[model samples]
Target: MKINKNIAISDSGFVFNPVNGESFSVNPIGAEIIDMMKTEKSYEEIHKTLISKYNADEATIEKDYFDFVGLLKQHNLIDNNEEA
Candidate 1:
């Protein structure tokens, strides 16, 4: 899936959605995920990166990744045209 093109993200984990004029903050991991999405990285690429950098196992990272994506959906932070 793709992140909304207008969203503004900061290195300090501040996220601003221009369409809705709403702001949010995320943890470091979440910020990393968003950054990857911003670059149009694929899900498998993100999963591999997270698994290598963090101590989490494959299954856990996969679950958490999808959960985070679901949150983005709930908030309309992602493009509706993309597949999840």
Candidate 2:
């Protein structure tokens, strides 16, 4: 999924949505995922990169990834117009 065009995410994991005037902060890993999403990376690529980079096992990483993405969806941080 793509991050909204007007959304801004800082290197320190601060997020801002200009449209709604909402702001949030995520942890380092969450920030990394957002950065990747900004680049239009596919889900598979994200999963692979995260699985390889983090010390956690595949199952845990996969689960957390899904959960995190779900949170992003629930919070309207990602664009829903396009399928991922």
Candidate 3:
């Protein structure tokens, strides 16, 4: 997914949404996930990358990835066209 134009995201996981006039922060894992989503990575790509780099399993990553994307949508951080 693509980060909204009104949002600013830092490498450190800080997110500021000008539209909502709010800011939020995430952990390193969340940040990396968002960054990958920004690149428009497919679900398979994200899953594969996580599988290779992290200790987590496919089922866990799959659930969390979808949930995270849902949260981004809820917050208007990403647009419909950008969804994986």
Root-mean-square deviation per candidate: 0.8, 1.3, 1.9
- TM-scores for every candidate against the unseen true structure: 0.95, 0.91, 0.81
Model 2 root-mean-square deviation: 1.3
TM-score winner, 1 or 2: 1
Give the per-residue lDDT digits (tens) of candidate 3, residues 14-63: 99888878888988988888877767677788789999999988898899
The Cα local distance difference test for each model comes to 0.92, 0.88, 0.80
Q: TM-score of the candidate numbered 3?
A: 0.81
Best candidate, lDDT: 1
User: Any runs in candidate 3 off by more than 4 Å, and if so which?
Assistant: 81-84
Ranking by lDDT: 1, 2, 3
Q: What is the lDDT of residue 36 in candidate 3?
A: 78
How far does residue 83 in candidate 3 sit from its true spot (Å)?
4.7
CA lDDT for candidate 2: 0.88
Residue 79 of model 1 has an lDDT of 79
